[model samples]
Target: MFKINNLSVKFIILIILFASLIFGCTNNKINQIEDLRKNNNELNKTDTSSSPTKLTPKNTIIDLENTDSEERLLNNIFSSVAPSVVHINITKEMDVPSNQNIPDSFGFNFGIPDEPEQYFERGEGSGFVYDKEGHIVTNYHVVENAEVLEVSFIDGLTVKAKYIGGDPDSDLAVIKVLSDPSILYPVQLGNSDNTFIGQRAITIGNPFGQTWSLTAGVVSAVGRTMRSGNSAFSIPEMIQTDAAINPGNSGGPLLNSNGEVLGVNTMILSQSRSSSGVGFAVPVNIVKMVVPNIIANGTYIYPWLGVTLSNISLDIIDAMNLDLKQRGALIINVFDDSPAANSGLRDSQKNIEVSGGTITIGGDIVVSINETEVQTSDDVISYLVKYTQPKDTIVLKVLRDNTIIPIEVILDPRPGK
Candidate 1:
């Protein structure tokens, strides 16, 4: 039994020694593999450092430097113009119909009569300082029927404002801020004529009651005509932009890249009543003509030709038996006892049916005014709005009876001036 135990112990010791030898060999192999990998990596690094071949990246990298600079530029513009912009809040008094006769299901009055309720409605818009004299320019609709006007600045300074005057024809109004002159910073107005499409447009206003918001876009178009809600005439030479103009953006400044006021943001064309990227502004040129007159007098008097004009159309040309290449403003009707009537300007004498519809014939086609060719009614209207004033004499070249004739007419103040 002693001899067998010694043999078993010897066998176990041999097994243990064999296992250790196998493990040691496996570990040495792993270490050698690791060393080879390390050497390979070192050789690659040395080659890369000494190599002259420039490795081009497989992925395209966009440089965001210009984008970063653009953001900074917009931020700078907002900072500089925020002080000049103002938030306008108006309280309008309205008469609500009294519910005096509260009728029961049996159709009999069940309540006593009460007086008409006076409702005070709150509204908000935007404007900018016009001059050091505290005159602030805004839309006419913003202050229309406003019983109380409150203006707020960037520093949260709220002050009462008195409506100096408003030209509903141009949809422009001026209100005198009842605040200290130190808080007023008048904005620089740019020439709307110089504003071109694709140029950067920036708008700073209180959109959706969020005071002093900024929106940036490009001028989509120029020389657009917008109809005034309170005037018979349309505001001409408007600037159209794609900036996100909402309800409270009306009367704000649509600025150029130079931080100059290109126009006053007036309206947006949207079915949702929110911004759909289409917006219009009353051009600064019109503001230039109308604002000073509003400050000097009680209103801005617009020049009137006292004739209803329409663009020359194919149907009208066919009906009037005119040349197909003819293009001008067609006088549809002349107002009685007005400038066009006093100067013997002819109107349509008869109606003739055409393929499209009926058109009036025998009216005078205005080919030119003041030596400038009139291709459309807009041309005539734009010319008068920009160049002529009330009582200014203008010569019109009219095509009548297959012959061109010159007529002199003195302009008069538009109705409701």
Candidate 2:
């Protein structure tokens, strides 16, 4: 049994709570001191030049030596955005009324009460204000099934937060607190499309309910993918980083060097169950794509393709006798009345017997899209995601025996009705 004092637990919680925001900062507070110096005689001719009596005017220089290179970034980022972020303590009622129960005669001194008792389950995470009306953004799993949500700030203020919206697919959620908007420090949204790998990435949040914690790292990779929650839907275009993200760092902002928000830190892969070299961020591109609809409409819209696709391998290329592997997506199945079907993308007719029990044939194999090469299923999806939008035309270079066909396929949204 591990014994720890209350203050020790509190300190550990505090350190974990401010996961990424405490290190590598040099205190250089930025002050806009006007450079008040007269330009010899030319300054004396201005319309309202504060009575320029220039003899030999010297300038005052203030160099804050303790300021580190990143202090400016920290100040600008934390000052303008700290209020938007909040320390969240979620309490869940773990007791459930169920017939499954252990007998009191078991060799255990513990006994269950006749009535269902409340078990206070507590967890901590972070969130950011998403809207002027005090809407906050955080990870969905951070507050999963939590009965009570308490939000706090660095200034010793606290409020009860209300659940707004969540998409398990993206692992993101919105929360709101009834508070004064005038005192709220909202973060500015940046263009994630412009975010590049190797740029500085920063995170700020309440890790383990310790408020106003911040950390920084560089963008490790772009266009990465991950999956989250029970629905098991795929998340694409995620950002990978080497930042130190721990358990309670969920839903914190991953920032660029310019102090612009780039992503939201959501998960980590570690053997020790702490931050390893790999931390994953939900790119702000995906966040912006989903959050507004979630805020306004209480749901998210996803772009979909009607056909299932498979990656083309050298074996599949040889076995299928493909003309060229870099043609397009090999459609295994197509939905009825889909835009792909209407656009003449055919589906496999019946099950083709192979090593497997059933296989489909007859569907047209897609070769290429516009000028982009489609060597695999991922290639096809990436090509479509980059070049085509909903109800947009996609030129598919298809192979049909010895004859090649150029088909103009119009893309459609997912979840076809």
Candidate 3:
């Protein structure tokens, strides 16, 4: 017989397979990234023969025809975005040699040492004006552990910015420069809900230190959820695009055809560390959800269930003789002061003496919420999110032993006290 470790590995493989089946690709995209980049360097650049007049005519009345609507749209989009979009340069601390250091004018130390080299993790990305009061939006991972921030715009203006607020759960940050409101060109917000597949999208950013560049593509998709920089939490309702968002594209505006900002381009799913036709933008909806809280309180809040859960195994269900027909979140741990704790919901984690021996207890399976069926834990949470406030109450049907019990519980906002 094979070892138990082998059986565990097999079980793990099966779970991963199940997850993949549940979350498969929405569509099979045809990647022409290579073909597009093959001559992109030459594509943007055009050269004219030394003097066409010398070869042809003297000063022909070049009655340059009027620009088309597309050109006008592009020009307007770029003009509205050029002033607000800014470049970000970050310096993270790294250990280096202590002795090998050099000083600058006001005496900023940086260099290599004899024993170890003192290092600074310097990197660059971009951001855009998020508000009128000098506030800007960017990716959290871009300046996660940054020490200094330098922002630059297209008008040859650069300034040192201050880290105002950030949320790692959503992978967003808010920064601000010390400047007048008129100097900052705030981007006009667009309704992401208005964006549909095949609608145009434009992004302006400093990719690879190349500043104030614009690229366009159609809205590839909407409500695309993925696990990108936020490894712990799933960034939900993402906007997927084939818009060629690259390394420095993070925090750039994802604009609609009407020159309105829909989202801030954040993550790219690529095999070669570049835009591979699979790019994701944190939906402006999420930005709108988190930005106000971050600006006011320096933090963002999420809805929390205040309980811990673990996937129930088939073997455990069979051994416990629990009802197998019911499907929902199996409660594992409930906090002492949680909403569930005051709802008369019993946590099964109690040691009991049957007759002379012992009994182990924990959590019962939540089979349903209200009249709606809880197919999975996600369904339970999704239903709760539809509620406008936490004061609302929800009814849960739980299966314990061979009997079904109803439990009513009040909800509370996450990141709670």
Local distance difference test scores for all models: 0.91, 0.73, 0.76
TM-score of each: 0.81, 0.68, 0.64
Tens digits of per-residue lDDT, candidate 2, 165-235, equal 78777788888889888767777778888878898888887655556777777888887756675353556
**Which candidate, 2 or 3, has the higher TM-score?**
2
lDDT of 3 by residue, 19-66 (tens): 887666422222355556667966667567553454546455433358
Stretches of candidate 3 off by over 4 Å are 1-68, 96-113, 116-118, 306-407, 411-417
Candidate 1 lDDT over residue span 61-138, tens digit each: 544476777787887788788899999999999987666677788888876645547879999999999999999999
Candidate 3's error at 287, in angstroms? 0.9
* The candidate that achieves the highest TM-score relative to the unseen native structure: 1
lDDT (Cα, 0-100) at 347 in candidate 2: 69
- Kindly provide the TM-score of model 2 when superposed on the true structure, using C-alpha atoms: 0.68
| Model 2 weakest 10-residue run by lDDT | 24-33
